[model samples]
Target: MNRTLHRVGAMCAAHPWRTLTAWIIALVAAVVLGGAVGGTPRDDYDVPGTASQAGTELLRERFPGLSGTEARVVVHNPAGGQLDPALLDRVVDALRAVDQVGVAGPAQPSADGDTAIIDVRYTVPVTDLGADAMDQVRAATGAARDAGLQVEYAGQVPEGEPTEGGLGELVGVLVALVILIIAFGSVLAAGLPIVAALVGLGIGSSGILLLAAVTQVSTTSPSAAAMVGLGVGIDYALLLVTRHVEGLRAGLAPQAAAARATATAGRSVLVAGATVLLSLLGLILSGLAAYRTYGFATAIVVATAVAAAVTLVPALCAVCGRRIVRRGRLDVTEPQRPPLTARWAARVGRRPAVWAVLALAVLLLLGAPALTMRTWPQDAGSQPTENTVRRAYDLIAAEFGPGAYAPLVVAVDLAKVPQDSVPALQDRIAAVPGVATVSEPLLSPDATAAVLTVQLEFSPQDERSGELVDQLRAETLPAGAEITGVTAVFVDIADLLAERLWLVVGVVVGLSLLLLTVVFRSILVPVKAALVNLLSVAAAYGVLTMVFQWGWGGQLLGVDHPVPVSTWVPLLLFAVLFGLSMDYEVFLLSRIREEWLATGDPFQSVVRGLAATARTITAAALIMVVVFAGFMTNADIVTKMIGVGLATAVALDATIVRMVLVPASMMLFGRANWWLPGWLDRLLPHLGRRGSAELDDPADAAPATEETASLEPAASR
Candidate 1:
């Protein structure tokens, strides 16, 4: 692996323009082709094997019109005056005349007569709707707006102009650039990673657009993909750049430094990237189309990042040459006592247990809220307050009730039941405790099936709504009746995720454990790493629960009230966070193992390894945290949850887990940290031998003299 990476790096460095031109061409082609042919992402809430899915499929097959998109045109008289009945009729007629609107129900006035809602059903599904769908709706409602009524569209209406969500990513990159300039003290050095990351992210985002063209991709996929891609892209390049700088300070030529850095840090990058991809595979087990798309979308960006890290970054490094190294007035020429991190490591080493206990206490305390965590799928109600859909939701919730925003659809097969009993069934359903109103059944064209729209007394995100779904399924609904629609689908999704969350966690953790054990040839290290990573993930979940669920500090993130954590967050967080945490682990542990093999002193190895890798890990982790946190500015609540969750996990993992727990635990365990049972060692492939040889190369080693040591931080050594 080392030799292969070294050769690849050398080739890129030797012919810099060729490598760079290839990436440029790829990026341009991806952007242009994707824009011309790529598909728009649309939410498909169909979860196979769930009752809701079955009912939705039945609707498509039988009552096709009802299965298509539906929206509500909400008109409110904010002045508390009654709407003109003549104007309301004109509004209904305008909606009916709009293109693709199959049905526009009569305006239903509120009890107070201050607001009215007209239900509009489109002939086409959401995916089939044209780009001007929302524009047409807006145009149709203009008359109502002109008459002094507040007009808002809700319930399956197309989203308006895309949010300025990319701004968050831009800010994250700018911040990372500043940090890099300060750390490397060279503008060129600072710019390399940023450039590579941008190119990679551009390509990856275009790839997502293309992917959306072929299959269902969630609206949330792009934001999630960008968050992960930007962080790792810069992080991977930063690792190589740091290593290349170390080689330069040791008197190696630019080409040699790039090759050596590629061989060493490049290998760790591959391991880290592979682990992340592998962990994403666990999402396939989620049995949800949205999650699978999210996983694949994230994988594309990560792959591109890794490719740019190894090829584009090295080419840029070679082109820059000695200029990449910090020199002139900024250079330190004399001994500064041992690096601050090394000194701190030594201090912790002297009393390992105390540090470990303190770290654990912090993690455990942060994680306590997870015990009471609740999750529900977010709806338009969670949208930013300024959004039209949210405005519609609030108006309806205020006048009619929150439940009016999300009505459930019941699909029933008339062939499986007596036609005369349909009215009796509706009566029973309406009599159910939580039932607010049940519409009369509308039969299919052939009269083989019927559809009923049921409105509950509680909002979609409320726990009572989900409970009613279960009760209707198990107690009230007939054998052939299945509950579905957006609200029911969300309820089923919550239940599905609850059942499979642990399974995905187990798969990700088990696979990662096996991979780490094989890579490091250590039993205890993999086990310890998994445990600490889990702690960090749990702490992140607790924080998410607090902010989003318990409403602690919710207003700061733009949420007006508490909401259940998005149902898929815990599962996705576990898969992504566990793998990301391993990035720093691999970088740190690999160096420690190299030192251990060379000197056979566990204590010194831990200290040197932590000292050598701490700064890089800190910088990389901070970049990741900021990148993730920046997504809070996104208009999507689910995206905000993911961003905050990822940011919190990375922060805790880097500081509490990596800095305190890992070092202290290694020190306390001593030789056990490297102990692998003989049988297991024999069973595992010898993956580290060549990498170990590469690290041990005298030519690649850091300067041994005190003066050089002082000039360079332990990271360079």
Candidate 2:
């Protein structure tokens, strides 16, 4: 590890221009390639088992007469539900005149005889109702209202508009920039990392776009790539620049300081990047194409960020070397070490066991709410109340059947049984509970397959919908030999996700353990790290349940009522939070291991290590929390869940896990913390000699007999 760092550092010093030019060329190539192969934006629920995809397939295969599903429409009334006959005629005329509309109807009087509904459907595919489709729907609805009728537009297509916008990304970037500016207190220093982060994001996004041209990557790949890349890239650059500034404060010359910063901080970045990549790659075991694509894209982005951090940032610094230091500070004699970190180390050493238990108890309490977590299947219209589409949808649902907008597709095989058999099949399906109506089946052109449209009594977002799906898949479909359609696809996806969830978990846990083991050179270290990471994850899950599922703080957070968390949220949290939580574990333990190797006294090492790193870890955690919290401002439920989940994880990991639990456990375990079986130690590859020993006394370990005393932050730093 040291040798590689030194070599990279030396190359940077000798050929700064070459390093800078090489990265620029790669960046340009990535952009050009991306432009030639643009990416597709996908809805949040674009996964295979999602209702939209399944319903569309069934419509095409079994219900050919049905042009497409009618997910939503807008009805306009000049004075609420009452409309003049002439104006109503104009509204009907305008609605009928829309070339793309498949269905159009005037308000049908309700039992109360006060309100009316105007139903409309699009000629285009229902699956295409993202931002562009929603815009068109809005335009059509506006035209109807302008014709002098009261208009209330409600449907799934319009409901998803707020989420599809780039609101979350914008918030995250703005928050991060503000925080960085404050942290650095200089425009150049803050802007440098932002520039590096943007370069990483551009490359990562372009790479995903280019890859999508060949492979069927998820439409959500670009957004996920951009979000992940920005956070990680900025983080990597921060570590490097912080180290460089510290070196300057230590009175090292420009070239020498840059070399030391690269050799030390650069290696840490490499290890961190590798760990994050491996953890993300573990998502392939999910067996869901969506997750697989996400895993692949995220891994590519993290790798690119790491590369840019070490190569691009270093090269830039080399060119602008002395300017990085504050003016007239060439001979400043600031301390060479970190003092705030040393204070935390000494505090942890004082009562490790007491703090450890307290921290663990807090996490367990926070995680208690997870037991009540309910799963909500994908619904196109699940957004906050303040959203226009959701409000419009509620208005529509109030007038019509809850399931008036979203319907299911049922398919029957005609070749095996004959067209007459489909009626009986449809009758049987209609008899099932929750089936409000079943349209007659339409046979395919070849007469091999037919489809029926089934509208349920409940809304598509209701839990009853999933129950109905289960009944169709397990009871209805199996009753006949040759029946398959969108419902079947959804059932298949659900089964696949359930069966492979554990495999995904196992892969992530196993790979993460392996990497930690390799990095720390101890079996116990990896096990402890994994346990703490899981605890942090569980706590985050509990918080998610409370906020999203139980409606705690939902209104304040811009969430409307309580909704089941997305199925993908847990898997995403597991992968992302685990990698992020591991960051602190790695940072804290690496320093501890360094002290232990130098002092050879477990007790003293714990004190020294905590004192050396606490402040930096805390600062980093704060920055992450601020950036992640910004995402919560978005009205989208899924994005809000992710934002809250990440912020909670970082906060808990840093304060409870890093500051309290880790110190307490390490101190309580004492010598056992470093003890590894001879065979296992030999089996794992060592990262390198401890940095503390390397920087201090290389030939001698600190005396074990030295009185075990708390080292002050001043002494340690």
Candidate 1 has its poorest 10 consecutive residues by lDDT at 707-716
Off by over 4 Å in 2: 21-25, 43-71, 81-145, 148-188, 216-220, 327-341, 385-392, 416-418, 445-448, 475-478, 481-495, 690-717
lDDT of 2 by residue, 1-717 (tens): 765664576567557799877877888999998887655443323345444454455445554444443434445343555445554455566666655666567655544433455656555544444336655555655755566644555543444333553465677677777766666555666666777788887888888877766554654455555566677788878777766666555544445556666677777777778777877887888767678788888888888898888877766666776576545443343478647656666676787777787888999999999888765544445676666656655665665567655566665555455667777878888899898888887666667767677777887667777677777766775333332233334344555676776787788788888887777777777888889999999999999999988888988886667888766677877788888888778777877887787778887777777765665576567767876776677556666788789889999998989888888888888888777788987888887764722432221122222121111122433
RMSD in Å for all candidates: 3.0, 6.1
lDDT of 1 by residue, 22-135 (tens): 999999999998999998777766689999988988888787666677889899998999999899898789889887888887998999999999999877667666667778
Lowest lDDT 10-residue stretch of candidate 2: 704-713
Q: Please give each candidate's TM-score.
A: 0.95, 0.84
